[model samples]
Target: MPPEPVAGPAADIDSLFQRGYDRLYADDSTGAVRAFAAAVCLEPGHGEAWAALAEANGGGAAAVQAYAHAVVVDPGGWMWRVGLAEALRLAGSLNDAIAAYRELSGERADSAIVRLGHARALSVAGRPAEALAEYREAVALRPDDAEAALELAEALTGSGDALAAVELLQPLSRRAPDDAGLHHAVGRAWIALREPEKALTALRRARDLDAEDRLGAAPLIAALEAGEGADLSAAYVRALFDRYADRFDQDLLGKLGYAAPELLRAAVDRVIGPATGLRVFDLGCGTGLAGIGFRPLAGFLAGVDLSPRMVEKARERALYDDLRVGDVVAALEEVPESWNLLVAADVLVYLGDLAPVFAASAKALVPGGRFAATVERSAEEGFTLGPTRRYAHAEAYVRATAEAAGLTIRLMEHCTPRREKGVGVPGLLFVAERPADRPQIA
Candidate 1:
């Protein structure tokens, strides 16, 4: 009798799935993608594996395909459907995402999350009228939902009705005075109405309610005094980003829809001409979002950040010729002033004072070297710490600061850096050059 064929050990699917998630949670997308692909191959109907695979891919064609399969394998699963819809949304398939959400609503019409998503999809798709209606409906269903009110109020404001945004929240305020977003919205609306006193009052309440200061304590101070500003310390920012590194790209690119990096790259090409063979320095280069955006233009790319975790993520991209975790100001101080371009996409928002960064930046660049950055636009005459614990700078302040630092503005224009509360956050992107003839400052 022929020797019995050796039996192969069974596939340890649970172990494989767990390992896939471990890699994903640690931000090892490539490893996680491989593990998840193996899990799915072992069991095609593994809805969770499919979903994990979708997340690993970060919402592209691969994610769309994975999520679609997940929903197919588990038609009755809520997360599967939600994941598919969200994946579709982030993939820029607005119509398909909306249709999927609508179909889900037909089956489970009471899901606030689904309706909220539907409203957002509609808003981004430029069907604001329909979006407004759905937002109103979502708010009605969950009157105390801060996120719902935020989106609804933002939508109202976008429609040129700040008063309505205020009015919509006024009743909610009495019902939930402890709601941070409620008071924050009221403060924003009051400012729009030009009622300084009322704005200060509501902003104070918002700060008090936000014990963790997620709404930021700096903005509260700004309302009380012209020069009052908030500083989001390096430690706070580093800690915040360390925890965020794993999902940074997804949250910023897919959901919040950050595009400042691309905007800065465009300004570089338009203002500096060909960027090829130029030395590029990326300040606060979190996850290399800005690094990859400008890599094609660089002969050499280098980056620095306060968050080591962010630096690590940036390193994985292989876009930078050098990446270091250090104080941005100090790093710039150490580097020789030979860079052709420096860009900080959404980095200065954590800093209340622009003078020092600008001064350091001015000294770090070669003659005619460019510094490109973005800041939240302030309506007043100076910089301010805002409700989001991020700093905003006035155009006047930015221009004066640039001149004082020996840099001349090449371009300064209004741009949408990202979406906050489902609305475009107003910002300014500028490319300023070190005067070729200016003597180096001691």
Candidate 2:
């Protein structure tokens, strides 16, 4: 997928190396690996062959070893170093990726592409501020480059400076009038600036240009909805969580002041007392924030999430006894009546209809077991999907839903689940208990 490791023509190259190149372009990764392995065997000094071998092997442990060998054989090959850095980044070795990226910067600080790559690595490592600095440098190096401008605009947006991002992207939009992605970026920045009309205009233009472009379609649909929708698409939610898995905690907790997990744990404690040795299940657990907080109260803990990457991230924390990668409802069905304490803090935002989740939570809980969670509160009856792509539920609707689902409300209180743009997001914290006399779920 990365361009050939070597510079210039491969016309004079050995037969094995040429055979490997043919196999690689043909998409036969295994054959390419074997051919490249043969080429490197014949010429142990061929750094390019080793690098090619690494790529053909899909950049696993073997790839890392081969890339390391390539770098050693050709210490001056910046391309090989870049390959290794990219491999490390894909493998979730963020620190190693950053170190390798720094090595590239040391070789050529003015290389805009290398600087951009380093900035991206830093972003993935949850160092957005540092990534912003690198992006600034990259933009300064190549002001007219569309790629660098896009990166800088995205970084500025993430840093809560949509006006700055708009300024950066406006000129690019004019320069590349036909670029659908550029328009999409500008529309998102406008939306952040509270200019919904402008965002709609730009997004509509983007969709007109490229109907199938992913960024334009999802946001365009959300923008078109304005303040009403049943719920967001499952595919979109999965993609969003997967992409944010790396920086979910840093952005939500440190940047946005998200305290739902702590609040939910406290509420649970008040309802069941502290350290009750409950069997806990965390629905839509992203990185196990709530699970970690509830660990002391649990005799056994398990987690479930729609995004596999988010599940993997939670697994890395090693707090849960088990973790499932699929829909929350499907996960609940797997262990009916197994949990004494089920937590879904900040996860209800994705479901505009609370009936399904409420019913599932009721079925999954043992007699007298508690369901504690947070939800963005709606001013009107029932629920509505907000412009932020999260659903907000009304207090009356929640109470009625819990009653119908066979759960008794133990506690309901107002709280700020998190902040957006330094403003608190209004929400509700609730604890409901399955009736002790209710029949067990089949």
Q: Estimate each model's TM-score.
A: 0.50, 0.52
**Colliding pairs, model 2:** none
Model 1: residues >4 Å from true position, as ranges? 1-230
Predicted candidate 2 versus true structure: per-residue lDDT over 263-322, tens digit per residue: 998888788775757899999999999988988888899898987789999999999998
Off by over 4 Å in 2: 1-230, 440-442
Q: Which 10-residue window of candidate 1 scores lowest in summed lDDT?
A: 1-10
Model 2 TM-score, 2 decimals: 0.52
Residue 283's lDDT in candidate 1: 94
lDDT of each: 0.83, 0.83
How displaced is residue 105 in candidate 2, in Å? 30
Per residue, candidate 1 scores C-alpha lDDT tens digits across 274-377 of 65888999999999999888989889999999878899999999899999987888888886587889899999988877888888988899998999999999
